[model samples]
Target: MTDPSDAVEADRALKDKHRTMWALGDYPALASRLIPELGTVLVRACGVKGGQRVLDIAAGSGNASIPAAQAGAHVVASDLTPELMETGRRLAGEAGVDLEWREADAEALPFGDGVFDIVMSCLGVMFAPHHQAAADELVRVCRPGGTIGLINWTPQGFVGQMFATMKPFMPPPPPGVQPPPLWGTEAHVRELLGDRVTDVEARTRMLRVDRFARPEEFREFFKACYGPTVAVYQHIADRPEQVADLDAELAALADRNLRDGGMDWEYLLLTARRAGQAATGPE
Candidate 1:
């Protein structure tokens, strides 16, 4: 077994790699094509109202943050990637929505306790190296009786399966690092937020992607824009056999999930209220 200190160091290094991976590519180019509407759905579901303090943690390019701010909420968007945050700022400005953008780690948020009325993330915080730490921070930053909204790719969903397909080519995750897809499961969500929140609810949604004539085209699109996929493609670039194997697997997975010549990316949406006295405010 790896020594405890060694494991800590390994995880820290991995976190750095994650930050670099996100910063490497233009994620907004991909994020904008998919899941923009989901942000609006999440904000509406969380019941964000004018003047309520809202936080979008692990917010990538201000997808949810822009909509929340447009709804008149006092929105602050936080993410680990400065590049993504900059993109978010530009988008917010274009939308005529004023927002405070902060470069923050999901595991250790730079915010006070109960500082926000609604804390939200869309397919973002689940990528943190420490799942429990990220979950705790989400709960910590939200006031009691305030809402927490999340959109995660379920383990059995298209995106999760895509990650699984790439597993053979990618290096194993560090010990003690939980699979991000666990956040998509109701049982795991209940366990993660144990006794800290009430009225926890979940629902599934299908996010459709336009179909590609060839799987190689699909692979190229992700490798060009999606950080994790790009990392794996680069990691296996020297090995032709592994590359062929990955391409085959990805093609098969994509074909299986195809709906009317398009791809159906299914995900889970979870919303819960932190346990405490409800605050009377605009929301």
Candidate 2:
């Protein structure tokens, strides 16, 4: 069995790997179709009022933060990886938006109580080692009547189905191992948020995943963007060459169903508003 500490570091390392690749400015180009639209939707859902202080948790490359700033909100973008936060800062500058960037952990925020009118995370909270604790922190720093919005994928959704299909080819951990809790289900999100938020809303959208026209492109994209899964694939396929074969098979599957120049993948958006009463400390 792998050491628990090693597993934790591996998770962070995998995220950092993606962060470095994302900093190279490839993801924005590849994810151009879905990312911008998703970012816009999340920002609008936050209902950014002019001059409102907003905390963007896990503001990877400033996808949602830039839009919030564009909407005239004062934004503080935070992420566990400094590389991502720096990349976000640079992107915001290029877009002519001013955003304060901070390096912080999602499970334990560095802000005071009632510091932000809105706290939002786009596909962020789900990766927390302690998701419920992170959720509590978001509520702790949000002012009374403030909103805590989260955007995450729903389990058993289209993307989840894709993962399930690919799982058989992936590697395995020791045994009886559990993956980190990502906000992939509505029920999980609800349970994490608990009674802190008075209003909860969720919306599902089909995100078009294009940019992979060839099998080789899919191989690079999947291995780069989905590193841990690739690690699993390397382990289970019994050899390195077999991993390439698996990618080819998946690419062929994707190619068979291409419509309107892109493959459609479903994603979910969830939003919740904190109560008007005084904020509750972390649970």
Candidate 3:
């Protein structure tokens, strides 16, 4: 029989690796300059307003949190990586706005049940190893009738294709871990949230991501600034052939996808309301 303590330790170790992976690249800079203003989109979609209590889970560098705060909402930005939160703290301070930065895991958010009027994640939370746990937490902390918003890269988007290209060069993920892009599909998300939510709405939006002039530029930028890509390259550092293969594949993905002016990264923007408050209370 497996010891409960052993299982706990294993979970901790996995999270440790995840934290380390994200902490590797300069994500704050990447989010600020390279990535689109996804949080703004989510905040607008969720209709975040002043006086509302908001929680931005897996909020990297306060992308969504800062905007929510700017909208006059009381926002708390939480993520497992303290480093990213610190970057967000700095940015918020510079903007003369204050956001409660908390280091918390997506699967087990450190917040009370139905505590937030709005819960959001922009290109975040989907990376959580356990989809069900992450989805449950998003619903659990949101008050009845409150909104839960998310922006995730679709499985058929450029980012998803990039991940697929790198898959051959990467190690297998932990058991029970689902691909992050699954969160971007309407059907998958519906299944995950189940009947706990209502007024389900899903929209496919395109973010212009023409940061790189060439395919090689995309590969180089991600290798240097993106955490997941950086981690993959680092994982196979000793394997020169695999590294070369990944480099070639990544470049090809960007090259083919690049369009008239730039690449249109497709993402699913989903918003839903938590089913009315539990009859009694949270179990």
Candidates in order, TM-scores: namely: 0.95, 0.78, 0.96
* Cα lDDT of model 3 by residue, 73-181, tens digit: 9999999999998899999999889889899999999899999889999998999999999999999999998899999999899888888888888788878889999
Q: Would you list the C-alpha lDDT of every candidate in the order shown?
A: 0.88, 0.71, 0.90
Ranking by lDDT: 3, 1, 2
Compute the lDDT of residue 247 as modeled in candidate 3. Answer: 82
Tell me the alpha-carbon RMSD of every candidate.
1.8, 4.8, 2.6
Please report the TM-score between candidate 2 and the true structure: 0.78
Query: Cα miss at 242, model 3 (Å)?
Result: 0.9
**Which stretches of model 2 miss by more than 4 angstroms?**
1-34, 165-182, 214-216, 225-238, 278-283
Candidate 2 lDDT at 20 equals 47
Predicted structure 3: lDDT? 0.90
Q: Per-residue CA lDDT of candidate 2, range 1-283, in tens?
A: 8699997777666555544433453444433444677778888887887788999997777888899999999999988767566667778889999989988778778999888988998766665655667778998898887888777766655456556656677545333233332476767778877887877887777777677666466656765655344555646566767676667666776666566767666666777777776454321
In candidate 1, which residue ranges exceed 4 Å CA deviation? 1-9, 211-213
Measured by lDDT, the strongest candidate is 3
